[model samples]
Target: MLKLAVAPVPYHWPRARILSFYADLAKAPCEILYLGETVCAKRRALTPQDWLDLAETLRAAGKEVLLSSLSLIEAASEVSTQRRLCAGSEFLIEANDLGAVTRLRGREFVAGPGINLYNPRFLTRLHALGMRRWIVPIELSRQGLETMQAHCPVDVETEVIGWGRLPLAHSARCFTARVQGLAKDECALSCADHPDGLVLYTQNEQPFLCLNGVQVQSALSHCLIDAVETLQQLGIHSLRLIPQSEGFDAVLRTFDQVRRGATTASSAVEALGRLAPTGLCNGYFHGISGMDWVAPPQVPQGQASLDAPAPRKQ
Candidate 1:
């Protein structure tokens, strides 16, 4: 059976709210939970120890926790932080960057979505170094995954981003701060203002993208709640669900019900729409553009309902 994992908090939530959120996750159906900061270095809503503290609570709740590393390494301090995360993390490390993998070379780790695993040879090299599970990058099509898994080690687990806005790109410069006319250095913590991430719109008022500190994301929510069978057939073992600000618990429940056969895929898709209401996109899975919602034939049959997007309040 495939595992249902929750990625770390991508939004810049307040410390208190973050604490409360994980406390609630104790009751959620999440089997695997990836913790720690993976986005901006400035969003220090929780300290290393604070995250570990929550890890203990989550583990008690029967969730396997993993510490995630930053995707973009900007400075020596960040390198030091990654090394420290690998060395001291109570749980296995999720290597978003190669440097994290280097630090965790002799130990087990999950390859995060930031790493490109398109080449089976490259994946083989990582598997030799202790990559137990690999998260297929958001852009790679299902065909790419099929090819990689054919040659990779049998023990290597495959996980995919099942939902949430796809994190597209990351840079040293903070676009969220830049748009607000603030330098990355002296900019206020503006990310805290837009908890779900600051929405970026096109000139014609179409949803274009979103800004989450240094990370750029898709405007439409990426979903695969309807593609459970495809994932199972592809030999994938985990569905990584990124945390959203609202309707997160519902998202977890819906995915769980769908995966466990308790509810139909159509019913799960409806629940996801109500919980999030953001337009759905599954193009990347079909080897097309990342912004289109092209569901496979085996998935539930229905027009995706995204009438009310999650409010973008400051």
Candidate 2:
């Protein structure tokens, strides 16, 4: 059975809200939960020990817990945090950067989407170092995944980012800081002001990208609720749902129903639309551009289809 894993929250929220959010997640139907700071090191909403404590709570509730490392390492403090995450024996570690990969020498780890795993050689090296599973990079198309999977060891678990805003790139320079007339070094945690991320717009008032501290993401959420069947056919072991501010519980339940064959893909997609901040997208899965939506030829005859129109490029 395909499992549901909630990726760690990317934006920084208030401490009280963060705690409440996790408490709610504890009751959600997700089987796996990733905890820890995977973005800017200065967020400080949760310390390393704080994340471990949350992991313990989730583990007690029969959820598999994985600790995530920062996507960009800019300071000695960040490197130390990575080492501490790698040293922990209590939970699985998700390495988001090459620096984390280097420190996770003999331990089992997860190659996060940020780590470049475009070729068989890279996968082989990680496998040799005990990489148990990996999430495909957001830009890699379905055909690319097929090629990589053909050469991947059968025992290695393959996961995909099935939901949430597509994380495009990460950098040492904070774009949000620039927007606020602040430098990356002196930026006073401006990301917290926008729980879901500050929306960037084009000159004509069109939504473009989202600025989440040092990470830049697609304005439209990359949704694959309608691609569950195709993902299963491609031998994907699990579907990852990145945490957002709202409707997460409903999102998990919808995916669960679709994965269990209790609900149709289109039905799940419609349910997702009612819950997500933006409309769903499956372009990256169809081998079209990352923003296009190519409806499946067969739509379970007579069922009401809820597919999106073809994408219009900006």
Candidate 3:
């Protein structure tokens, strides 16, 4: 059966906000939740112990919890913290970088999307290293996934990011700090000001990307509400929805409805379009530009646009 999972928050939210968010999420319908800071280490509103405690609370609420590590490790302190997170928890760790994978050898771990497991051979090697599951890299197309699965020799749970902005890249330098004219080390937790991430625009005033501390993301949220059937056909085990600042509960309900056959994919897509103000894109999944929005097959081509506004409530 295909399961629904929530990814860790990729932005810097205040401690109280984080606590409140998880308190609400504890009752959410998703079967799995990832907890921890995955971006800059300086944005530690919650201590490592706080994340573990939250994970326990969610677990008691019937959700599987995993601790996620930083995608870009730049300091010895960050490495030490990650080491503690991996060693101290009974929960599985989501290894975002190669170092995490090396540290997690002989233990079951999840290969996060940041790790590039492009081909069958690499995946097999990781499986040998005790990778029990992996999220498909956002840059990989559906066809690419299908091809890899057809040739893969091991059995592992496969997951795809079903919603939220695509995390395109991570850097050692903080873009948010640079934008605020502050040194990286002196960044005043500016990322907390934009819980959904600070948007970066193009020369033509087009919304291009989002700068969340060190992580760069697609300005438009990625939606695969229309692709549930396709993903199931390809034997994907889980659909991961990254948490956003707002409307995430509705997003989860929409995906769950579609997965349960209570709603049609078209209707779900239409309803979801109203939730994402910057519109939705499945272009990366369809092997196109990550910013481009492709309409479902039932809808005519060109019906979807990058600048699409959320539909008004009738």
Candidate 4:
């Protein structure tokens, strides 16, 4: 059976709100929950002990938890922190960088989407290094996934980003701070102000990108709620749903219903559109532009679809 896993919150939410969000999520239908900050380490809404305690709570609530490492390792202190996380045997660590990958060798670990798992050979190497599961990079198409899975030499869990804004890139310079005219070192934690990230628009006022501290993301949320059967056919073991500021509970319920056969994919797609007010996209799944929404054949007439994209550049 396919399973759902919650990715750690990428935004800098307030401490109280983070607690409330997890408290509500503890009872959600997800089988796995990833805890810890995956972006800028400056946004310390929770300490190491705090994350461990939360992991224990989620585990007690019947959820498997993994601590996620930062995507960018710019400092020795950060490397030490990841090493400490790798040393722990209580919870599995999700390695987002090569440093964590090296430290996590010989122990079961998750390869985050940030890692370049572009080929079967690379995946085989990681598998030899103790990678038990890996999240498909957001930019990889369905066909790409199929090819990689076909050539994969060993068995490993394949997880895809089922929902949330696509984390596109990370930089040493904090884009959010620069936007606020603050230096990266003295940014006053401005990311906490925009929980969903600050949206950037094009000249025509079209949503273009999102700036979240050092990370850049797609303005529209990535969704694959209607592709459950396709995922199963591809032997995907899990759907990793990234945390959002609102309507996530509905997102969970909708995916749960669809996966459990209580509702149709078409119905789930409709519900998902309403949840993501900025609109939903799955074009990356169809080998098209990541920002465009290419509706699946399962969708019926009159359903809300974000299609009619400009012709792809030849």
Residue 273's lDDT within candidate 4 is 73
Question: What is the TM-score of candidate 1?
Answer: 0.93
Rank by TM-score, highest first: 3, 4, 1, 2
Model 4 lDDT on a 0 to 1 scale: 0.86
For model 1, residues 57-164, the per-residue Cα lDDT tens digits are 888888888889988998888888888888987698899998888888789988998897789888888889999998998888878878877886889998989999
Cα lDDT tens digits for candidate 2, 1-314: 78899998999988788889889878887788888888888899977788888889878988899998888887998888788788765688899998887888888899999888889998998999999999998878888999988999987999999998888888878988899999888899888888888878789965667889999987767788777887889889999998888788888889999898998876676577666565556678767667555544555655334355332333
lDDT of 4 by residue, 53-147 (tens): 99999899989899999999898888888888889748988889988988877788899988998898899888998888999998889999999
Report the lDDT tens digits of candidate 3 across residue range 62-104. 8899999989897999899888877788999999998998788
Off by over 4 Å in 4: 301-314
Reference-based lDDT, each prediction = 0.83, 0.82, 0.86, 0.86
Candidate 3 TM-score over all chains jointly: 0.95
Which pairs clash inside model 1? none
lDDT of 1: 0.83
RMSD of each predicted structure: 2.7, 3.2, 2.3, 3.5
Indicate the worst ten consecutive residues by lDDT in candidate 4. 305-314
Provide TM-scores for the models: 0.93, 0.92, 0.95, 0.94
